[model samples]
Target: MELILKTPIGLEKIAADRLIEMDREISLSVKPHGLEGLIVVERCSDKQALVNYILKNVPEVESLVNVEVETEANLKSIVDAARKVSRGKISEKESFAVRTVRRGRHDFKSIDVNVAAGAAVQEETGAYVNLDHPDKIVQIEIIHDRAGISVTNGFRWKKMSPDKKPALNFFNKISIVQMPYLGSLEGAKEVGARIGRAVQAYEVRELVIAPNKPVDAYELNKFIDGVIEGIESRFRIQCKSYDRKVEKVRVSVQDLYQLVRDRSGEPMIVFEPEGIQLIEAATKLRKIFEEADRVNYLFGSREGIPKGVYRVASMVIDLAPGITLPTELAAPTALASTYTVISMIEQNIEDN
Candidate 1:
């Protein structure tokens, strides 16, 4: 196979139909050999043209792999195939990794092929092995006795790799102190749940419910209950989907004024209309976020923060001047803006 097209499962037929319509000379198989979600290009008048067409025209195709070698799916054959394709493709200055995907029964497991083929490729070409962030990837697609092998530039989307301290990681360092929305029990609960999900979406260092004045006990309880429910549901999905250990967002209640007092030494940012715009504070905020042990952010609900608290805050920010955000949007907007500013800071550092 010159190229293998991957589509969402059950969309293989649509991918094939589009390919045939693009060029009558191109020959391929949909779901080749009973495999699902795969189309193999057997022959094409112009391989490059077909690849370009597939990329631009085929919306259903997820990715297209250009196969360099088609060989028997034995360990020895696989190793030989990998070594043959990788001869001068990689160098010692670059790193490569062998990724094997097996779709049928075989005596040797996928790891066995990775080890044998990786060692073989490494022995033949003096390239380094960096599985986490390889410069090149030797892809192995095995289907029972038949296997297709290819070399490709690795995907560069693993922003959370340990070697990288990505901007998103800073979310862990932020502490969001938001005043709970207090009104009808239903409205309070609904707003609380939205705020809770927003907080846990980042899994921030801490989420503080800061009430400025007396609130109805039933309303507060309902809001807290909804917050708990929101945290639980989102945390469940994160636990199942996240690769690392997911920490459920911590919930705490604090009086608005007291919280400002207690976190006086740390960097505290209050969001309010009277405060400086986010753009103006970005430079200062960058330093605070990067240096502080925990950066506290205060978002008001029904009533704005006590003007007194702004004086004690390290920096007061108006996320959006003139336009007031809805109750649920306040914290999320803060999170997104912080993420953007820090990313800009990192970019500046890199550019320098």
Candidate 2:
């Protein structure tokens, strides 16, 4: 099997070196080409295994794509490659889009490839064209005269092997904290400091904040930007925020759910407290989290979660018994609990 490894532009050799070291027995060949972060790997015994190994061991590798066809770069060749890969790969009921990355100057533009390949795939599979959120992605990489085609679904291409799983699963973790904007801007900044500490402690990368009532977008962004800056002072955890103007907790929660679904093409495992399941046992929570592709933890502000917000939750977990903590405390508490559960899960996996 053949595959493409995407790395930083100048770091292609680093990734290729690691692959060469790992492919001793498989006799794999790595060719760095296009000078555009593309490394082609050919003659592999197990492509999936190598991908898993690279993802776990090689930090420079950004993504991996299993190449279906590598042919001359042109509109007809790209259309034919898209058609061939979409035959059994993309279903008629699924929605698909064509994504083209052109490295060298050519007669055709990238949008031209996307349009032609998208039309061909739609005609061949009867699948609708969805550019925003596609069920299947037909990726075409054109470097000068050569082009590689592959069909994919999600952002994560490498799947970790069971035995080589890491302790902290950062890719699958998401945290949503409700901003306590009911108070003055100073009070909000204080609360932001606490939220920043929580995010840093938990090593969260994606954060979604819901502003309280009477808070506008400008104020919310200003407040949350302060919190993110505070987190950056001590520990470096790159975070992306999903800022919404909704005051209701349910609206923010639903927005986050939709955002995750749109980007990942799968439902996230949402956990919110409804005073039902206790968050005392890490083992039980770990088992539940292991089943999904990712986890989303939701916390409310001073007003607490809305009445019907629990309906969207996959599991309602009670953090504090018979008492509701404030947003500042609740955010950190839930994040710490999740980190502990994931740690225990990883420890158990390592021990076994």
Candidate 3:
């Protein structure tokens, strides 16, 4: 079996060298010059064993594609190869889709290959097409004059991280609830209650409150503790303190700018009505968050974020366009919108 191992551009040689050093049984060759991101491996003693080893040991390798056929890169050649692979692997009762990726200039576009190859696969296997979710995937990769075809039987190849934590459920996310002091004690508590409800509704993991002038750290912490207690008592969920217990409400008191600066390594998104629209911002945020190890969202109070605080912000989102909302309303709106985008992206990742 021939497999295509994809690595970041300019790292193909390093990945190829590592594969050769680790597994002497497999014959590996870096794809010709100009095809800088791919290494072709053939003559593997065990295909699955090599895949597992690469995924576990090679951090440079991004993903692996099982190559069904390595032939000339052309419309006819691609379609014929895809049909042959799909016929053997895809059952007549299953639904399949053709996905083509091109790395070099070609006479035909990727969509052209997809349409022609998809038609050929359908005709050969008598299978219907399901673009969103398919039982089988016919993947065609064209790099200059060479092409690799594969029929994936619902098996996905992902690089494995030994130190990676288990995937998080809805409840496991580490979300921050930023409650800025709104001048009056009654006002702060009232806004805090609304923010607290948002936290409970979204199942946030952490709560951080900023002590604006006149509101000391002790007072802010006590106020947040009370707000959390109220939320628990109201919902009967039994929230735990920062020490960790049943409801699990970990609260902290810190300056908003200082908090953002401290967590600079994590992806940060601030919600401001003057910023970009939420929908477009959410798309970009999803990509950034996916690549980041941690994520934090910042919401402003009536006074708005402290001057120069936005320097640490990676993105500024306008959840409500052309209108300004009070801190209480904006806080929950930002949380709900951000959570919705994250959930949507997570679902897309799972589906694909």
Candidate 4:
């Protein structure tokens, strides 16, 4: 399960650092999915303490939106419910019928009932139906001989993953830095240094800098280099730095496919065989992040995903115009510095 942390207006680096430190103090672990996006933190335990911890620590939080929780029972129920809801038949009754499906935990909340009214009647159809998309959803509750029905006029839930949404729409005006050679750590230090310098120079603290490969033996190296060289080479600040080991490694599409027998189980790709090389280049980003051993920490997006409710400080950078990412992918902000790089400082919600 994941919790989202949202900071729509903006935040600073110290604020972000404080939030992250506070999250740890609250016993919450956060993951950074992207900049200018929500920070997603995993709920390690099934107990409600995770939510309580976040609510207790995060003060500027707006709301906590639990995207979805996948458990053995939930997986089974989701599969069964989806099949049942999608395959069921919709019938016209004596003017009205309301149906409700419980989702998430029973103790927290369940899906409200969807009701339809009118004098239409269909003799061939049954009561079983699919309410995936509906115009009106009504909530009904019965207790102690008293019944409550909430009539929500129009509310639509988004059931698709963030990747499935139109990328351009979701990432509008955001600058993306794509490092296709993230498979190794050779140049990670340089890349991290440049990225940090760019971010700091640009005055934006939040950033999305993926290594060129899924696992960079050099990701920490590059971060260390960036922190050290960034101060002397890029900025005039004097600072000490070193690499922190990553427990897990990130993977590229090709590496992922090579490592896994079932590529279909992972995210679906639409490119043809001729575009395989391009796809490989597009998905090559390492997922290793260990905080630095210095006063300032340079977190790796490929490794250390951000936690929830924390504010991120991003330095803005513009990918050169006409520059193409590996496999012909293009950064949305390639032409301008409109996009802001982000790093999370708190845990309030998970990235959707």
lDDT digits (tens) for residues 82-166 of candidate 2 = 8998899888999988889887778899999999888899999999997766788999987677888999993433344434444
**Model 3 over residues 1-352: C-alpha lDDT tens digits?**
3898889999988898887776788787686545778788867777878788888999999978888788799999989888888766988899888888888788889999999999999999999998866788898878788899988865444343433333334333545636475456676676677767666655566667765345655556545755676466544553433222445456677776567667867777777766788778767777776576556767667666654656777777888788888776776677666768767776678889
* lDDT (Cα, tens digit) per residue for candidate 1, span 183-233: 899999999999889888888988999898888999999999989888998
- TM-score leaderboard ranking: 1, 3, 2, 4
Best by lDDT: 1
Q: Candidate 4 local accuracy as lDDT?
A: 0.32
Estimate the TM-score of every prediction.
Answer: 0.88, 0.46, 0.48, 0.22
Off by over 4 Å in 3: 25-27, 42-48, 155-352
Candidate 2: global Cα-lDDT? 0.67
Give the per-residue lDDT of model 4 (tens digit) for 1-352.
3454544445423334555564553333232322432343444443356557556865555444443323232323333332233222332331223333332344223332222211111122333233554433333322212222333323444545333433222222222233332434655555555554543333322233334234544554455455345434533431222132111111122232232233223222121122223312221211101221111111223322122101232211123424333221232222112112111211112353
TM-score of 1: 0.88
